[model samples]
Target: MRTGPRAAAVVCGAVALTASLVAGGAGTARAASCNVTTGPYQRQVEQFLGRPVDGRQSAADCEAIKGFQAKHGITPTAGYAGPLTWQTMSVMLAQRAAGTTPNKDGKCPTTVGRIACVDLTRQLSWVQDGATLAYGPVPVRTGKAGTETRTGHRQIYYRSIDHWSTIYDVAMPYAQFFDGGIAFHSVDKSMWNPPGSGGCVNMRPADAKAYWNLLRKGDDVYVYGRKPGT
Candidate 1:
């Protein structure tokens, strides 16, 4: 993910990929047979994945990169150290830099009793109690291009632990509806998947479950920033 505001967004160029791998590790069968190709972000990805930072793709490097791409739902896993793969690494680094004080910038109001803050730019969400950090800075998938998640202040008006989307006919476990059909919910898919959610904030199952337990009906939900590609 590019850092800074949308106006000054920077796209990192990554190196080329030799082959395409599947979404899951099922493609592990061909890991050894992957052709070697170097990407611009090869060195960075290697460093991020704790592989040898030679800025070149090796059999081992291909396997490692493919595994990460698979886990994060980066399509055509392909063992390529491409922009998307590097962006995912960037997001992880940013999250690590956030540490516990996800509200350090105070973009999320501290005045609210207990607020769930969504930073769409960073694809991260966290809960705060007054000035105290209650949870997260966890990865999330927000609205995609056309169906961008609505911003501004809102509150949890309803919740359903075993909710299934009546509109999409998909399971949304631990759903906490804050804005009409949009909710904070758990998706079975990877949080890093591109094109994002259907105007809802999609979380990992564990994070959603934790939010369900920590938050209540009246909790504030503040969403801000523009999701990339929106």
Candidate 2:
């Protein structure tokens, strides 16, 4: 999948683009100069975004940083290397460091057969068969602040490949309901979207489809930790 916001359009059937189209169009405009004042995480943000990593702001650097900010719905989207942006990057780095053994800490119960592990702390999800990683350490967008995704051990209770959310009126493809209305599904928005999902674990279309294929009813689903902003 494409990491940049523009890639969202490439995955048309996966995400509902009605609102994001407008936002994406606006993101094309040149960022203003007000964001020139570099914050404390300048070096880190620069390095993460693959900018020059000079620890100093430049016009090109601002544009690159702003693009990343826009992708994550970070406020201002003005390219400032701020704390929140750096914190998000840090979580991503940790997730990458986990590599294949995302459950090395054993927070997810290995006793269960064919289980799905959700690490809310890193906003990542993966499937496990015994100690083997059957699938992802893929990026995900989980529940937002007051509506945080409930943490605990649960199981897949329902499966709907093409489900519609009557409450939110949005398309939820490859949905696997594990807790109440919350499920693992694909959304039209970026997984890096700020504030997170309504409660479900939102994934990319491809990742959701993989989950749909790997998991089924009664499979264990273990979700733990708290989402960053939540």
Candidate 3:
């Protein structure tokens, strides 16, 4: 089928219909059979996808599923939570629940105090306080190449509630400066459409503020891997 926004919408509609059909037989048995064996995983799926936990694969759920599938590298983008999608989501959910530790080679630095573990490869970043996850692995836009974001150990050295760049002349709100010029700040969410950052970590406004509240001066920022599309 033709792909892009229109195709995605069509797929979502089809998935919603499929889910509704799977929920029921014909007429009299509809309400009774509507509940699929989605179980706790279904709830997790709904919550993870930011859909209402209504115990059904809703239209919203279907679209969100498609988005989740694309983000996590799931195949087909069919908008259905089949075995593969469920399994993949389960593994990721488990990881998020438990928090991420570096692999054997130590791509992430293990720390006892508060630290921000950024997985540049996956475009996800989270904050942990001595193994306790304080924030998120939410979607982030790191620097593009040439202005390549320097990896390895760093810390939040300064912050500004509303910072204006004299050099770039752009607003860098909720800015927490790390690595000299690089900062963990909020920019337009639409910027992720093309995903370019000037060696700074750009997040959504709410996420940036949340990070500001969670982190303070001198907190560790552990950046790892290379930005995938950069």
- Those runs of model 2 whose alpha carbons end farther than 4 Å from true positions after fitting are 1-34, 52-54
Give the C-alpha miss distance for residue 162 in model 3, angstroms. 0.8
**Can you write out model 1's per-residue Cα lDDT over 58-119, one digit (the tens) per residue?**
98998898888767666666788988788778877877888888878889898968999999
Candidate 1 scores a C-alpha RMSD against the true structure in Å of 9.2
Tens digits of lDDT, candidate 3, 75-168:
4454566655665555455446534443334556556488887766656778877656667657676766666677888888877877664433
Residue-pair clashes per candidate, as listed? 5, 2, 1
**True lDDT of residue 199, candidate 1:** 80
Best by TM-score: 2
What is the model-wide C-alpha lDDT for candidate 3? 0.61
Q: Candidate 3: list runs displaced more than 4 Å.
A: 1-106
User: How displaced is residue 118 in candidate 3, in Å?
Assistant: 1.2
Worst lDDT run of 10 residues, candidate 2, spans: 4-13
- Expressed as tens digits, the lDDT of each residue in 1-230 for candidate 2 is 44322232222222343335435653653354548887799999888988787889888888888888777667667888888778789888988899988998999998878999999999999999998889988998888787688999998887778876442355668878787667788866667766666577889889999999999899999999988877
TM-score to native of every candidate shown: 0.81, 0.84, 0.55
- TM-score, candidate 3, is 0.55
- Whose lDDT is greatest here? 2
Question: How much is 7 displaced in model 1, in angstroms?
Answer: 33
